[model samples]
Target: MSNEHFSLQAEIAELENILRTIPEEKAISRLSFESRLEEARSRLAELGEPVVKEKLQLTFRGQPVDGTSGILADFGGKAVEVFSSAVSTVMASINGDIGERGPVAKKDADKLMITGTAVGSFGFELEVAGNSNPLFEEDDVTAGGVVEIIQDLLETAATGTDDEITEVVDVIHPRALKKVSEFLGFLESQKASCGISFKGKSFKFSNNSQLSNAALKLKDQNVKERPVEFEGKFVGFLPHSRMFEFSIRETGEIIKGKIGSKKIDIEQLSDNFLKAPVGVTLNSVSVGEGKPKYTLTSASDIRAKAGGGSQPPLTQE
Candidate 1:
């Protein structure tokens, strides 16, 4: 593993050198080089080495940035908020991609590191850090993957059909959906345009007033009425899908839903709670017909009544 790690690192260094030599006007050559570079870095990261997985050039264009000194102070503060919010959006989506739901923890939502500036526009290059930790071995979605989703969602919002936009938004973490909505709202409010570029692909947001519709759609999705708790037996859980099954104690009914807690220990849950009496709190969303969609918010073991008094109930959120 050590040898392979170093070898991958060396390969990545060489690829970066070749990529730097490639002219941006040579689109095909630059793309090929960048592809190879990203592949090498991904491999290195998978070996537990920290790698710069995604590089984005964020360029802001508007009267706020039209000056010889730099960006306006008032706009700069809002711009900082916009940049941080974008990173948080990516972090929340990463959690969702890895089958973890709910808001991202501060420790888990590391910001993209700034790395130099763009030439013409007042902008900076944001570098996303990556590593293949053991915890992420199963459903690892690197920073690059998250960036691709952002690009796709933005592209869809700008041009795709309503159904297409909804489809993409549905997959995003609910928290991220809200953040990106705010991100777009900030852009619209300032009447400023911005561009995000990764490798050969670039997306620009200008007079896209239709983004208001997308923002409304996102806000609507985040509206949850209230949480309802149920007493049941923990039947099963699928880690990759973040889905769980429960058998209700009251009516002998079976319910399945998405799990929203990252603190759950799969092994402990299987050993201690499976087929055991438990309490589940869920947030339900109505879908028009049939059963509503459920998201499990918190759960607790309630097996103490059946000779399990020695151990305190394990609860997680």
Candidate 2:
């Protein structure tokens, strides 16, 4: 899938230029200023519109993001500015020093809020639902929590006792006990979750937290909770949905393993990733015996085709 990361400000600038030449008046003497204004308004109209469709996909950490396609939103509000500044001062950390990420790509990527150095949970949720702001602080909180935990762990390893190491591990990542943990599930719990068993014959909803007892039940006698984890940054995203910052770290699955076996030995274990909006994610893990294979069996149906005879940027009032 293709990513939609574009240069937003630049795009807006271009749109403004195009709209300015629209010739609103039949015989205007010299409406250079008016033309410019009209251009901005036209571009703003385009930008302000929600994404007609979006195709979301999840890619594991260390791996290239599959699709960069997504919606864009404006965070240039008074509240955002005030809090952003205050946050910079109060946090006093390198992470919080975000003014704006200028010109990520020449194609006009957006300037959303995030810790300066971290890839926060959000990935510009395209206005697929009409122009809506990305849940900035709420989502960032979870991302920040994970970062804090990992940061603590790294610190512990640097200059702490063995006891401290264990302590930090328990608090932050009790599951992955290594000196480092790759990635936790995005979202502390999960906004949306679907569990499928028997190769997708049946599915379970995380919201209801109940499964059809008769639908391919797990044999409790053989079932064992060894440990579960995702590949580096490889959190599950429903089809076409936005990637989340946290997931149910407390419970995941240890597929195809006994009580003592807690490692996927497949040379290329692949698992399906759902980001919801409509798109499938493909990930590959280590290779070995008993390594589980993953495949994003489905995709979403929401996406606006690229390469519509795009004129220069323009804004709407």
Candidate 3:
């Protein structure tokens, strides 16, 4: 087996051993047991295979909600099939799983459509238009695809301008508007401006704060620490932290601007200089003030924009 696979197995084994040692007495602290369980589960997650059955929940208007009719695997397969089949079949499947008295009427099926999909730690949730047909086939839908669609939708809802937000509020269902707005506000507070990505239906949101890189690298114990460097355009200054922000040209990932102990008056720099291209190197990063902070070891290759006039490089030795 590959080294990575072997290491993951070893970690899982260690966690399992630790879990076994934990006493099963009622006197055991609930927090202690929960902490151990969480660690074990996380290590097992590194195995990259579903280790436990995922619960599924389905909700339909005019029908009793079925919170746990089946496992995620079964539900995922059925969802794909429903998306691909005729509208009638989709209605029948949903009704059958929920123990509804009868198949939905033709009028209801016409209203059936996939409103939205969201992924959580436990599983995925799908919102449908009034008995709406998702109009997707088994071949076209995958768990990852569902996640991407949701992430894109959420990002749009979160980052859109005020005008856009108003339009979204007017268009989306009233029930979902509040949730979308709340999630958007949360993302803003967390500085999730680098956008949201996913791993196995779980979100990995990127932030524009200084300590993002370090936090991401250290967030998973299974991940090894390493030096990171990137080239990007000096975007702007965050006066609140007295740092200059850079936008990675290739990935669009924002580099939380830092100057370390270097004595440079960023406010004195011209707007063009602030917008020049820069190279940044980071190591031994940490989080502070609710954001990632890192050593500003050096900033090099400062290139000014064409026609913006010549200016001194903003490199730090």
Could you tell me the lDDT of residue 132 within candidate 2?
A: 31
Predicted candidate 2 versus true structure: per-residue lDDT over 64-129, tens digit per residue: 222233212232122223322322222222222222233211101122243221122223211111
lDDT of 2 at 65: 20
The C-alpha lDDT values of all candidates are 0.63, 0.27, 0.39
* lDDT value, candidate 2, whole model: 0.27
**Model 1 misplaced stretches (Cα beyond 4 Å):** 1-50, 60-77, 89-109, 113-123, 132-146, 152-177, 199-202, 220-222, 228-236, 245-256, 267-279, 285-293, 301-317
Best by TM-score: 1
Runs in model 3 lying further than 4 Å from the true structure:
1-227, 268-272, 284-293, 299-317
Error of 3 at 278 (Å): 3.3
Model 1: per-residue lDDT, tens digit, 1-317?
35687788788889888878888899987887788888887777667643345577777776677733467768766765676666666655656542236545543424666777765678767776455434343455555566667778777777666556655654555567667767777766776666778767987665446555544445545333346777777688887777888788899888887766666655555666677666666776531121456666544523433632334334454
Off by over 4 Å in 2: 1-139, 142-148, 170-173, 176-317
User: TM-score for every candidate vs. truth?
Assistant: 0.54, 0.21, 0.23
Q: Best candidate, lDDT-wise?
A: 1
Scored by Cα lDDT, where does model 1 land?
0.63
